[model samples]
Target: MNPVSETQSQHDSAKDAFFMNIEDAYLTALKQNPVVENGRTRPQYCYYDGPLTDIVLHNFIQVPADNFSEFFSHNHLPIPELIAISHEGVVHFNEMPADIIDEIHQQRTQYKVVDYIHADSFFADPLLALNVAKQRNRIYCGHPTIDGLQICYYRGELPEHGIENLLHLELDQAIEFFVDTAYRLPTKIELPDELEDELKTSIRSGFETIVNEVKQQRRTLISQLLAQAKQVTPKFHDGEPLKIMLPSSRLTTVMQYCSRAVAKAFEKRGYQVWFYMEDGEMETNNLIKFYRNYIEFNPHVIFYVNQLNNLALNDKVTHISWWQDSMPQITEHKALRWRGNDYVFSISPVLDRHLALTGAKNIVRQHFAVDDEIFNTDGDIERQNKVVFVGSSYLNSVDLSRPEQREIVEIFIDKIDNGEIVTEAMAGEIAVRFGLPPAFVFWNLLHYAIRDYSVKWLCESTAMPVEIYGRYWEQDPDVAAHFNGELKHGTQVADVYRSARYALVSHPFEINSQRLAEAAACGCIPLVYDCRDVAEKPHWDDACLFFKTRWELLEILKTQVRPALSPTVIAERFTYTAAVDNFIKHSNIGELSQAKQSRISMFVGR
Candidate 1:
């Protein structure tokens, strides 16, 4: 109404917009900056970092892993297959297929790196629907592969140094060039007594000197990736997401969640976002409507988050196709892969190595957030010596055709029960012929079966005392067969847990398990297997004994685990509030508090 008021309103709106971008920018900058020595680069990919992650700095941490980020007491968790890609031209392929895994061991290969840059991109079907058409194809992993995570970089003209001609230096050589490079600062090549004597003046100066040297070195490496990013002839990338695509079937739910997190982070910031789940509906009429407005509206930015890029998502969108984890096709190690986003996000803290590789100067760490709402309800902490599982029914679907493998599982199961191991024939019949893998495949599997099996087995094994409870086990026949006819199914799990002492956790090979949290909530002190490939933590050690092989289970049975939990503590932790909060805080969404929530919010209008 009044001129003065209008002016102020406009200024404030502009200010908010500016500050928001600044926040995103500042956070992004953290990725390239070294945690300690500004010179040493680590990729800030995933939230979890330690001796293993510190080895080679990653950039922004992948969102899903960052969400449920936790360290086990023992390094006994199973590592999933991950895909990782870095600025350094697809660095390491760690999470190889099982056959490749065995071959690597058979050859005793300490480490081997593979690169599949041969793939290229080509667009087809301009208005191809997102979800529908793909489903009709009835297949997995068959989309045209696009290299470079879909994002393209192009600076106007060549800057004297041709990118292709520049010898691609090894990362170490690049880092070494910065660290140990011969710095002839117009004086003696060697820092003799003069510089050595300077240390006596102030410790700060000595540190500054090291810092300055590293900074200069970092510049050289950045120049390599950017100025030297593939020596193609100088041209402008009016680039768009190519029609090219790839099947993401193998890319687990964790991958989907990470992409969602990454997309949402940007959406909250004001960038218009579009994520085409293979199942998303993008049929022509809608596609045309989406396209017409995209062109008519002429949005400010277009962002893409996926395993590829370079396709035109309606030419007007400022397409930024980024992979949030390790390029799955590249890095085989899931941990390393999940942590590496093809591009960068604002919620996570980035490691320096990746910043140098991507030549990304403005990078930030966006972490997932804890809701504190899900774990809000009260739980009747069952203090019983029982185990419970609350996940998939995979255990009941084993295909027992593989008797040999079945034997291993039975042996594993027997060890799980402190030696009342199931015979191969028994396990084989239950797994293969019974339409499943093996009942005793792992800690995760153990979670599904053992609650009832342990209870039944204990009932039969030694009267050593046991009870089992879970969602699906009650519906199982094996448990029914063991039934001297005790209560089965439903809240019976909670009942058994309430009465039990040692709450068994089917943690087996996973770095993390939902059961661990559930058991903790139910006040069941878990008998957990120590998985090594993931994080190791304090309470984990205090709470559960970490074991691997069945033999280790014997040691656990003899010690570590106890019979009961203080009922009060169980109520405190397992309450819906605690459960939800822990899941949220530890989950990737927790990192969103630290990220630009604008990304996810942006898509809302779309």
Candidate 2:
């Protein structure tokens, strides 16, 4: 090849490499931060403000503007448009567009026209607006100084300060907060004459609209809930297998053990039980695949163990579900997507009422039952003197750590302390506090209060010989000394229960834990809080000792307080077999069983 052509080829190759490097860097920055389709300040790559000469560049390699000679002079290509680290610890591509424009401008006489890049970039819109907002002191709750969602502060000194203190809030929550404080804002601080009527009226109108929508939504949700209250006649066919659906993954050891116990109980009762286990695995991700598989199995009934999804079911098949965890009041009140389950069961009585009030007609309250064969301890095993607590941490559980929990706890305490627990004034106060149209704070208040009480009671209660075992308790210094590490879920847990003389229980909700029943079978007594859900029953008083206060618990622990019911009696009362029997009886499966109707063939035609 000619010498001129060879040199031209090298320059062209260098240009391609530079552009490719720029593209790669721009794409990388986009992936590092969250993408908001219509956001003002989120990091992104888009249009340039002006031609190559107009914008100032930072932390970039300076290349001579008028030279292709410089590119050929170096052996390797210079990727000037790649990411540059700024002095202020920010990751950005500085003057990235200018290099691209310079390269394009060199090839073309006039400015290169690009249609897609239109007026948004690090240099053009978001950064400039942010700086302007900072100067004007208008950026409120989302100031850069704040870290995470917890701590936030507005930077500006305000003329009407008390009226518009922006707390760290979600988009919807900010709107609600504005309306909540709007009336009070007008009363305290005088606003500009032009801003007064317009802003206040706008907020009041929005508040009115939201109130109307909430009422409408409640009606709609209740109607949808009432639709789910269909009664299906039970067609219990003997020898037909009962199909059980479990999650495809993250099945805990305790769940697996409990599920096996239920399955074994069915087998013992002369009905065939089929688990969806295939190739030593029993799980599926697709709803269609599960449905088709269920159809093929042709089971008498289907039981979903805490599964919550919509799937088509065979008309004749009986469907029932069991939910173990509690959701917030708003979440529970909203219509749930279920696969036409005829009956719904909840472990917590708190949940049961929540479901009922929200329109679930056939709601049954149930509890976790133990398989005595697996959980049983040797009668002569020496019981340790320490009082053991085997469960997960309640106060710091994922459900309780949400943004709403703190507000809920504060409001509940305030109302109770004011001696307005059952008053209309308290209800109105709660509604305003939570931004609920009406007071739906009962479940949330009870659940969180109980959990907080449990934590406080444990820390302040008697200095009894105690050992705590659960995940995430190691961080808490109070629990740190007593923490005996996380207890393994299955029979190993039962052994721990057996070793301890008494198991301390303080469940926030009414959900009967397997540990309580297992402890009894292990010849360990259970000392539980006298919460309505846990100790409401007469039988519970007989089987387990109940305490209302820290002093009450301390008094009991001063001696080796044995339960009134014997281990055998407790085991007999709380076994999976007994649980299953109760379920079958309560569900009215036997009475509603399909019976054969007498039929005679007509011979007159023959």
Candidate 3:
């Protein structure tokens, strides 16, 4: 993943950002040159002789819009029939021609809209929803067309019947195409005579000896786009020209075992990376503002972790996405709503299946490589019986539907507290109050798991009071007040993991509990629940234990388990090298950044 070498090879990379930036650069060069405005190379577009500042690329003809059906119609590209969309019970066949409606209704049995949440039902933020609705409407109906004959119509909470074709992909083939493009060096040769001969020969060589020069040009273009794009929505960067938009809520927990792995991949790949503050909210992450202010935060390419957030609604679209982590627990699970365009990347088989059912594009699956620093254990060696769970209960709302989540939280809290957790204060914290979004309305299970579950289990049984700590728990006086014997929440929280016999995870029924990995990293034997989670990965062997009932948990505690990862082992685990290496190998956006610079300076040059 040597970026230096990569830039040397792919020189045209910098030219990909937009015609807006280069238009100004080229205009400036034209102004500086003693050139005549002749027929052969007259200034096709007007430019400002002074600075060319007003010649902004953001100003284009009509506002940028998207919709395959409309695009096809405008371009006169052949397209097919679209799926019907139900809005508030009124079935609106996507742009159904006036004549096609009655004929189709008579011939085709009307499929019910199913009163499911629609793109328009997003009431709290009508404007934002409208913006997204414009895009989602395209995917909902545009792809279902097969040369104008509707094959399927989607109108429910669950995906339509047999939608497997949407996600069908030859992903490995795509990767092979790019990965197989090995390092190419520039070919130094003598000049050829005749214009046609020179043109033919130059095209043939493709810069074998000038690979670095080309890569530098590409890197520069990407950086310039980064800088200009930032100004569109400057608030996202706040101030610095370097920023990372971490659209994470509980990824900290999910990636406890996976973070260092990913971090190392990003760093080793020659990416100038920084950890940015995340709004941590699932609903209001203000992505558009980030795009507007991209110049303030000069990243070559934007990456969002997993599938929770994407840059689809940003001021300008970007090649913005990351590989999804394990979501096995989420399979066959019903979503509150499904907006295929809401995500740009997903490994969920359902995505492709839905596309096929409704006529969508193929989704490519790319995994975020594992960083050895955090995920580098040789095997599930004989560790210990101390199961340590690290997460909060607040995320259950997003994962569980209204009816099922209540049942899940109640069951989890009861197992550890013997039904003593539903106190007035606890209930207040967990209840759907203060009008939070339905998806974010779940109880703080991570905190409750620590306080109610772990505390009750230890206080009632002979197990030495299981240690519990996290960033928020350590800082809250009210939370601290509950722990009579332990030190208050603060930085001294690491000690809690050191003494634990088994880590505990009593999260709601969903896929991918991150705490399982966190506990493993800390060297406490993991005691993860037997319930399914979204991430499907290898199970814990002798290194951890799985429990389905309180009885099993107690039996295991009484007979087996103790802390295995010593403080020294945990300290030695911050190896971010692999994550960095992978980031370099996977990302070529940086090449665009280097190509635009005029000089071979030390900061970014070879």
lDDT of each: 0.34, 0.48, 0.35
> Which candidate do you rate higher for lDDT, 1 or 2?
2
lDDT of 2 by residue, 54-93 (tens): 1121111123334433331221222233223223533333
Candidate 1 Cα deviation (angstroms), residue 111? 49
Better of 1 and 3 by lDDT: 3
TM-score of each: 0.31, 0.50, 0.36
Q: Would you give me the overall lDDT of model 2?
A: 0.48
Give the TM-score comparing model 1 with the true structure, all chains together: 0.31
Summarize candidate 1's per-residue lDDT along 433-460 as a digit string, tens digits.
5465542343224443434343333334
lDDT, model 1, position 513: 42
Model 2, residue 142: displacement in angstroms?
29
How many residue pairs collide in each prediction?
144, 0, 98
Q: What is the lDDT of residue 265 in candidate 3?
A: 50
Cand. 1 Cα-lDDT: 0.34
